[model samples]
Target: MVLHDLRKYSFWGLLSLAINLMYTKIIFPCALLVRRPAHIRILGSYSIGRGFTSGPGLILDVLNDNAELLIGSNVKLNHRCHIGVMKSVKIGNDVLFASNVFISDHTHGSYIGDMQSNPLQPPNEREIVCGNVEIGDKVWIGENVAVLLGVSIGESSIIGANSVVTKDIPAFSIAVGSPARVIKTWDKAVEKWVAVS
Candidate 1:
């Protein structure tokens, strides 16, 4: 399974390496209007669906493979954000993404099939297998952050901007740092979520 996925993402990542951002100005607005979403605003050249558009610097790559990158209503992806979906990535309602955020369901590179020219060979592929990336309701993903594969961020969690989440985060927690540890817990009564001591 891992080998299969490794080949899947690596192949597509190279295949769909489009750097041109010119299509957004013309192709995006019409796609959204045709789809008729509540809101849409695209600034960069992202291969997007009809329902994607909000804020500037939002860059989407390889949109055709993302049959699973589902965005909820009132959710906004800010500028310079990258969303990569290989398997399934579901976002709940009212979520916000600051600048330079990245979310994906699968690893970017994997080797799942035989690299040699053979019709039938053992799949010599190493892959980072993950279930999915599910963002719960009212979540806030900060800038320059990477949400890795098989990572489930709980509902109402505030991921510190520019952090990398490689594991599952529980609900109502504030996670930060490279591996994104639970730095603090959200205290509804304190009028502010306190960091985990």
Candidate 2:
């Protein structure tokens, strides 16, 4: 009875190890290829650090040759996170992102011209406004969050769900709402987060 039980446990352990090997060696690489097909004209130049794990449906769109996307170590990105890099995107270590997070450093339509002048033109043909996005370490961005062009999110900052980050968020701040504003900031003197007026 003891030998039988030991064999059963060993079989299950071996099966688990085989599955992990398949996932790391074959499944993950195939998933990346399927998610980003060769026909897509996205040129990606990524400098990723160790311990980076991304869930399914990760899309990396690099619009230009000079575009760069740098992700630091120990970062976790949830499913369907789209990173559109037109200039540069620098993400620091230990950052966690929830599902459907979109970080882009460019805007698709031309803001200078009149809306009705070339309204029928395709969006892809329109001019792109490019900038750089910098996200510091230990930042947490919630689901459906969109970090727009030229925004910098500082270290230890928490961006609430569905927030549209349009500007710079200071370090140790808690920001929420559309066009996210800092609702709370860490006060070192008080050793706690204080409300921002």
Candidate 3:
């Protein structure tokens, strides 16, 4: 049993070293350790801090040349997480994202502005509307969560799985549901999470 455990650990350590070398040569310096099959398409300016790691099948796309994407240090994104940016998307330090999470800062067309999209025009050709997204430090985003444009998730907030966040989430709050609403808040007084009234 001991020999088998040692072999398993050795294999993993060697695999991690190989992956790190590949990333150092092919990807940016911020990719400390990343699993295989990551599709990163960058046409914009970006910066990723130290100790950043991503799981397999991660798609990070920055579509526009003027767009900017910033990811802080010690962030981990699980498998199949997609972040598509056309404007600006800033993620703070110590953020953790579960699998299959989608975060985008732009939509295909605008319905509220003067240059509204026409049905006659193809959806792909329609003008894109940009709304920057900001995720504060120490935020934990669950699996299958879609964080849309113009949304700001506050620091240390917890977003439940399968939730669609459309608006701002306050700091130290737990939010859930589609168009996620805050259900619990960290009570600093009691040093615990309490129901939000």
Taking the tens digit of each residue's C-alpha lDDT, what string does model 2 give over 95-181?
Answer: 999989999999877565565325687887877787799999999999999999999999999999999999999999999999899
Worst 10 residues of 3 by lDDT: 1-10
Off by over 4 Å in 1: 1-52, 61-67, 108-130, 189-192
List, in order, the clash count of every candidate structure.
10, 0, 0
| Cα TM-score per model | 0.61, 0.77, 0.89
Whose TM-score is higher: candidate 2's or candidate 3's?
3
lDDT of each: 0.65, 0.80, 0.90
Tens digit of per-residue lDDT, candidate 1, span 83-190: 765467788877888877888776534434654233354344433343578999889998789998889999999899779999999999999989999988878788
Which digits, one per residue and each the tens of the lDDT, describe model 3 over residues 87-147? 9999999999999999999988888757788988888898888899999999999999999
Tell me the lDDT of model 3 at 173.
99
Cα misplacement distance, residue 98 of candidate 2 (Å): 1.0
Task: Please give the distance, in angstroms, between residue 138's alpha carbon in candidate 3 and its true position after superposition.
Answer: 0.1
Give the range where candidate 2 is weakest over 10 consecutive residues by summed lDDT: 30-39
